[model samples]
Target: MLVALGQLAAAVVVAVGVAVVSLLAIARVEWPAFPSSSAR
Candidate 1:
């Protein structure tokens, strides 16, 4: 039971890490179109 729980925790951590990486990649791809804060 403890091993199963540990696996579940690891899976959740990996999922969150992937999500964050994906978001960062998307943001980097779209960054050029974003208006510069300094331009305001």
Candidate 2:
């Protein structure tokens, strides 16, 4: 029982970490500079 609970907690932590990282990555790449590059 304890092992299952530990696995569940670990999975939740990993998922949340991945989600936050993905959001940060997208926010980093989605910049106004992209439009400037197109005009060039």
User: Which candidate's TM-score is highest?
Assistant: 2
- At residue 16, give the lDDT of candidate 2: 100
lDDT of all predictions: 0.83, 0.85
- Clash counts per candidate, in order, are 0, 0
Q: Model 2, 13: alpha-carbon shift in Å?
A: 0.3
lDDT per residue (tens digit) for residues 1-40 in model 2: 9999999999999999999999888677876756764456
lDDT of model 2, residue 8? 100
lDDT value for candidate 1?
A: 0.83
Residue pairs clashing, model 2: none
